[model samples]
Target chain A: MNIVVLVKQVPDSGADRNLRNDDNTVDRGSANNVINEMDEYAIEEALKIKEAHGGEVTILTMGPDRATESIRKALSMGPDKAVHVVDDALHGSCAVATSKVLAAALGQLNADLVICGAESTDGRVQVMPHMIAERLGVAALTGARKLTVDGGTLTVERQTEEGYEVITAATPAVVSVWDTINEPRYPSFKGIMAAKKKPVQTLSLADLGVAPTEVGFDGATSAVVEHSKRPPRSGGAKITDEGEGGVKLVEFLATEKFV
Target chain B: MTFDLTSEQDQLRDAVRALGRRYGHGYFVEKAKAGEHTTELWAEAGRLGYLGVNIPTAYGGGGGGITELAIVCEELAAAGCPLLLLVVSPAIAATVINRHGTEEQRKRHLPGLADGSAKIVFAITEPDAGSNFHRLGTVARRDGDGWLLSGRKCYISGVDEADHVLVVARTEDAGTGKLKPALFIVPTNAAGLTRSKLDMEIVSPENQFLLYLDDVRLPADALVGESLDAGLPALFAGLNPERITVAAMGAGTGRYAIERASGYTATRKVWGGRSIGSHQGVSHPLAHAAVQVELARLMIQKAATLYDAGRDLEAGVAGNMAKYAAGEAAALAVDTAVQALGGAGMTTEYGVATLLGAVRAGRIAPVSREMILNFVAQHVLGQDKSY
Candidate 1:
């Protein structure tokens, strides 16, 4: 099996994030860029499948040059190699454009399977796997809490609000996973050192046969006209309870519809 | 001339910091207070190759030099889990064996040291010696093809956790019939070897012990290097690495203390609406300690770089100075942190006072600040030895 995992470099969700005032895109210049949190789980899943079945695991990422840091970090988690799609024209590309570029890169690799996170922390759209799968004309197993591969068949326990639904697909499928799948491993010292020597193939829009006019802000299907800072939290109602403290708490819960 | 760590080194530091934080100070203090070792953390670090960063790659180590090892030490310490055994086992025993041990000895030991599965502690300080090698009472006498060693070592750290102890003893010179120092790898379970734990005030998981080697017999292969001539140089080989790593650990502890205090003071409001850090009385001391810690860190970097470059003579001078600065800085930082935290710092929940004993001991153990000053006075200043 030749598996491809999609990785993204995003502003750390734990820290303060902002948007550029000029075009309202993410402010990557001042932010601490790290591998998307859920993408690590995807990487772990891809590595796991490769470990059990004996295949190559390749990381596929699309972003600017700084995204190489994330690629190296993901490689240290035991991936075989990486394909980095970097182009200034790829800037401000929305989910639709991203999936198109990624699909093109995946097409060149001839991957039998592609794995990715259900949603990115920054976008949280939960649509990249489906979009890429649609573009590749392959089956997509989205929101998978558990995945099993046997021969050419793939089975997944697709997570839902109530419970999980069993889904099955053949080879040449895109599987997007939830964090419930498995725990990720820390990079070992040897892995970190070896990652420095691993091959990282860099490609641009032209290299992928992607025209400059097909991506970037000009080709983006959606645009954010304006963005603003989230309002600071205001103190909620405080009750000074006397002897009826329990009754007051019940009343407050009822008023807030939490009871 | 550049102050920046290589990208790989930076990645190493970040990785170690994350690992340390995952365990955190709470786990460390809980283990220590329960009279248990940080066995899980140590094993994980070893498995991740953090423990054997300085060991040769052929022996399953990272093959990096002391600079890499120091980063591991400092990052772990900064996360409030300083492992003293790191200074002894990897820094002292591993380096000495790799540099001066015989090829057979290296083959037998380096792999284990590199993988963190084996720990070899060093034992040289004796109750009677008091830093004076001339007064060392530990003597090894030839018996057939083997040797018998007898002596009492005081304040040896982590003997219980190690499988072997590198014993430094004096042997009779065949040519001159005079005593000279030699190193022997003695198994901790060797016959006639016994240890008694010392009650210490430090709140640390590692324990110190008084080691008694009474007629401990060992095969001739136990000796490090090809001959007795390898003894002195082998013993000296471990000193600079030991001093440099210990200093890195001290500098890390200082950084930990200052960070804790700064975090507390910045949010802890006692008067009016302003935080306690708004007052110069509380903030100035922390700032001062931070400056001192930064200075000590620079010296540690210089010393480690010089040592790794194989300039042992210059490294000795810098290592001593680095140790002295770091020891004083660590002690001061912990003290100032406690003061800044006020009543909260005295409580174990705050985690500042727990390091008081360890930092205080740092100024005295392995090599004391006064002894370092003595070395600098004689070597760097061309002054007569005071002792």
Candidate 2:
């Protein structure tokens, strides 16, 4: 079995984030970029599968040059190798354009399974796996809380608001996992040292058969006309007890629909 | 020359930091207060190969050097879980055996040390020696095909948790008929060997002990190297690594204190709704401590690099300086942090005061600041030996 995991480099959500004034895209140049938090779950899942069965796990990342840092970090988690798709044309690409470029790259790897996070913290789009699955003509198993692979079949427990639904698919499927799937392991000392020597194949847009006009800002299907800072949070309502504090607290809870 | 750690080293730092944070200071304090060891954290680190990063790869280690081990020590200490045994066991005991022990000794012990399953604590500070090895009272006399060791060792750390103790004892030189230092690996549970824990004020999971070796018998193979010739060099081999790692831990503790205090003071408000950190009175001390800690860390890096590069002489000078600087910096940082926290600083819930004793002890233990200063004066400055 061969597994390909999608990794993204995003500005640390714990820190202040900004948008570029010129294009309103993410200001990656000035922010601390780290591997997407959810993608760690994906990497862990792929590693678990590879550990259960004898196979290879490849980390597939599509971003700017700095994305290699995140790729190295992911590889430190015990991936066999990595495929980095870096191109100037991929700059300012929208989610759809990213899916197209990733799908094109994945086509060359001939992976039996594709693993990714259900949603990215930066975008929260939750559509990359489905988009890539549609393009590749394979089953899209999204929001998997649990995944089990046996022979040529893939089974997942798709998480839902109420519970989870059992979803089954054949080979050559794309699986997007939720954080509940598994706890990711920290890279060991040996793993960190070995990651530097692991093979990381860097590919360009031309190598993936992607055209500049198809993925850049000019070809993006969606555009941010303008962006602004979120309004600072206001002081919450204060409750003073004058003997009727319990009644007033219940009323406040009812008003806010929190009870 | 570049000061930057290799990418692998950087990753190892980040990885060890993450692991340390997961266990955190709370776990450390809890275990210490409960009279228990940090078993879970130690096992996890062992499984991850963090504890054995400096051991030889052939012995199931990561095949790194003291530079890597220092990173592990500093990162963990920076996370508020300073393991003193890391300085004693891996840094001193493992290095001594790996460097001077015979092939049979390495094959017997290195694998256990590399995997963290076995711990060998160093016992050299005797009740009467007081840093003067020539005056050590511990002696080993020939008994048939073996040796009978007798001595009283003081301030020995982590004796209960260790499987073996590398004892520094004096043997009668056959030709000269004078007492010469020799190292013997004795099982902690060997007959006639008993230990009594000392009540220490420091809040740490590792405890100090006063060990009595009364006619503790050991086999001929128990000698570290093939002969008595390996004794002096073996004893000296562990000193550089011990100093470097202990200094790294001190620097890390300083960082932890500074980080904790900075985090608190940055958000704690008292006057005019401005954080206390905004005032120079509170911030300057932290900034000063930060500078001192950073300086100590640089020296630690230099010492570790030199030692790993086989420049033992240069490493000794740098290592002593690093230990002195780090010891002072850690004490100052922890004290400043406690003061900055004010009333909360005295409280255990604040976590700053919890480290007060440990940092205070760092200035005096293993090697004192005055001793290091004396070393620099004599060795580096070409001054007359003061003591």
Candidate 3:
């Protein structure tokens, strides 16, 4: 029961974000970097699986050196160890390239199972699970609303537009988790202190056997052509609901062709 | 000189903060109102090894110091659920034993203290002695290899919950025939020991006790260290952590009050068609409290650092000043919160008024504000001792 949780560091959800003017890319420097909120769910899920099945949880993340902060955070939540794929060439890598690097590392670690968020708050690509699964020739269960592992099979309630559909995959599979699965537990003070001694291995493209020509901006098939800041929204009109306010509201809605 | 916490420390702070938020003010208030102890939170904290952060690594505890422990105290207090036992148990008793206790003593206590399985409460204050160690009436007489102890301890926290009481007593030095201070591990259920709960004003989860030890007999192994010479250093070692923890709690409580006041004023509208926070009258006091709280926290960090580095003399001054500043900050913050909420602050539903008693008590207990000023006048200004 070896679990590898894929985590990411993104701009803090509460912090203000800006774009780099030169490339119209996100300004990772201005905003404080924090663990992707959805990745917390993934980490929690992995911890739960480990707790129930008796296995060690290892955190796996692909980002710049700054992303190690996010890895430490997951470790604080009681992960046994971590593998950080940090390389300059890893920057500007799309979902496909990112998954390639993750699969390579997971293969090297020989992970029994890989868990990830349905979508990272920063990227919102929602393609890592399927992409990594396709690259590894393993099964994938994405958009998991409810997850349970029994024997060698991993089962999930895949959320759909029309209710949900049950999905199951055999061992050595990829699974994407949603926040609705379970509330993440706060790392105990003991866990934080213990995490300092946990091993964190840093790897580059060479270490992962990833080619320099297959990652980063040069390797990315998609690129941001143009972007702009959204215009500041003005205040909306307020209506007071007096005795005849309902009639006035009806008239206003009729005037706007909404009723 | 650098004030920033390390990345690992920051993570530790965040983790404890999350734990605090999970319990929140309501949990503390409910427990206090129900006259029950916060045993759940305490057990969880202990089980997680947060309580043992200051204990040495070789003792089956986290290899941290008072600096790390203060972070835990401050964050928990900031969430409006300060664990007062932390001040007595880990910060004092644990530190003393780790510093001066024999290998047997350390082995018997440190692991349990680190894991929160066994709680040892510290008792130094007596009805007649107070802070004056020379006036202590507790005496331990050597009878063969064992000792006979008699003492009256007042205002001791968590005596009922603890397995043993670390009693500070006067004993004749083994070699010198003169009476000197010594520390003894007195069992709570010892044959001659009796305890009565004290009626206190503050609504906290911890209860105070008046302990009467009438010729309590203890084995020779009950003594903390081999020599009377080590007692003073052991006691001083405990005091630094105690004062530092007090300062942390005060700063945290002040922060909690200011947050409540600001949150209330930001939303509550009045006759002027503006939020109460927009008014100078409502905002200035909270702003002032914020500054004082931040300054106190800085002092606490400094004092904790000095203490862990074995600079007790320096830590003493900083710890005292930090405690005084933090007390004033807490008083001001809680006062402003009460005024900010007008009527709701008086009610227990909002959870602001419950802090009123606790904040006021923080100023006087552990050590009073005037005593701190006296210490500065005598110790720093080189003036003649007044008391």
Candidate 4:
């Protein structure tokens, strides 16, 4: 099976993010760039399947030239090659437009399977895989924990709000991976050395036969109105003394709405 | 010089983690209990070019340095299968052989050690001498071109598992009244070498041993480097790597404990009609542990960076500091995790308590916390040495 994994370069999950004054967009200053965390699992799962089944893994991502650092990181994880759909305007691209761009780029590879994270840490709308599936006209499964391929058929266990749901799809399909699927692989020294020489084909929006207006902020559907910090939690009531103080705390709690 | 890990260090961390996860904690525990080494994990790691992170690429190593090797330890520890032998074999013994061994020694030992096929455990500490290595009583007497070694080593981990034991012994000349330390490779099957397993309560796979080398003899080639006097610098080169590896192990233990607590408290609720995790009492400690673990992790990475850049002095200080921080962090994290789980924490099923002993090893062996404090006070702070 030939697999293609879609990775995104977003702010580190732990970074503090904010909105910029111009156009009220998210200020990328405090947000350190990294390969989306969930996407790490996706790349790892794809690599595992490729290693088990003897296939080629092509890491696909869309961003500016600097985003190739994320691709370089993915390539270091035993990916056969990488393809970067580079566009300066692609920054701050929403999931819908991002999916469309990735679908357009992935359509050229004719991959048997395309894997992606259910959602980027920056924007947790959880819509990319399904949107890419719609654009590519391929069956898609989201929140998958386990994926198995036997002969040309694919079976996947997807986590749902209720429980887990098992889905079967044809060989050529798109799947969005949950972070719980598997631990991501660390890149080796040899992989880092070799990734320098690996083929990372860079393509512009024109190369994918797509126009600039079709993606990026202009094409994005959702808009962030504002940003605010999560209010700090209130300090709890301290129970100092052991037994008698515990009774006092109970009485205080009974008097308050907390009881 | 730039003291950063470069991209290669990052890659090494990832690869080792992947391989480690394949044969994780469960596998490690089983092999450790069975008195067998995790040979599969070791071989696979070697095949992936990890066992030789700091060895020269010309000698079947990845041609990186101590930083890369340290990353390997941290990643594996995080995966719950920290390779203690990596400290002695690849990091210390292999490093000495590569840098100071004769051409024939390098040809015979480097490839095996690099590939993780031949396991080497280095012994420097003596029971009576304690950490004052200069007072060590292990002796090597000249017998023509060969030497006879007699020594008793205590609390040496992985002696039973090692193919070759690199014993550090002193050679005393009656006339000069001077004692000089020498490094020797004594095969486990060497005549008159007897090892009794140490019954340490720790849960690690490698067991400490009490080695009794009674007149173990070897050829002149068995001596590592030039002579007893020349081994100190070579020995010091390997120690920083060991420290880095230990720091990584501490980080791993901390991460494992924190992860357990994080998963437990994230859903284990109580009052407010949910899990008690909704209360600040449980959540705050977990959060604090998280922050400390991250800080320790940064230090581990920094030490690794300096060591990989060939900054020995900086690496030595950083490695000790990082190890100290990580050890404390891991101990606190595990303790807090146990407390968070409450009654379930003490239960073996939870596995959090199992980490307690492993993390404690970081504080005691390799170098004690008191010893590190002394080093910082004297060398780092310019204060008078207490010991």
Per-residue lDDT tens digits for candidate 2, residues B155-220, read 999999999999999999999999999999999999999999999998989999999999999999
Show what share of the native A-B interface contacts model 4 retains.
0.75
Q: Which is the better candidate, 1 or 3, if ranked by TM-score?
A: 1
Looking at model 1 chain A, which ten-residue stretch has the lowest summed lDDT? A184-193
Give the runs in model 2 whose Cα sits over 4 Å from its true position: A239-255
Report the Cα lDDT for candidate 4.
0.82
Ranking by TM-score: 2, 1, 3, 4
lDDT of 1 by residue, B1-387 (tens): 454687678778988999999998888899999999999999999999999999999888998989999999999999999999999999999999999998888889988888789899999999989888788899999999999999999999999999999999999999999999999999999999999999999999999999999999999999998899999999999999999999999999999999999999999987999999999999999999999999999999998899988889998998999999999999999999999999999999989899999999999988988888889989999999898
lDDT of 2 by residue, A223-254 (tens): 88999999999998888999999999999999
Which lDDT values do the candidates have, in the order given?
0.93, 0.93, 0.88, 0.82
- Cα deviation at B99, candidate 2, in Å, is 1.2
Q: For each candidate, give its TM-score against the true structure.
A: 0.97, 0.97, 0.92, 0.72
DockQ preference between candidates 1 and 3, better one = 1
Highest DockQ among the candidates is held by which one? 2
Q: List the candidates ranked by lDDT, beginning with the highest.
A: 2, 1, 3, 4
Q: Which residue pairs come into collision in candidate 2?
A: none
- What are the interface RMSDs of all the models? 0.8, 0.7, 1.8, 2.5
i-RMSD of model 3 (Å, 1 decimal): 1.8
What lDDT does candidate 1 reach at residue A32?
A: 96
Off by over 4 Å in 4: A1-67, A79-81, A89-187, A206-259, B1-8, B18-24, B34-36, B173-177, B271-274, B278-280, B284-295, B383-387
For all candidates, the clash counts are 0, 0, 0, 11
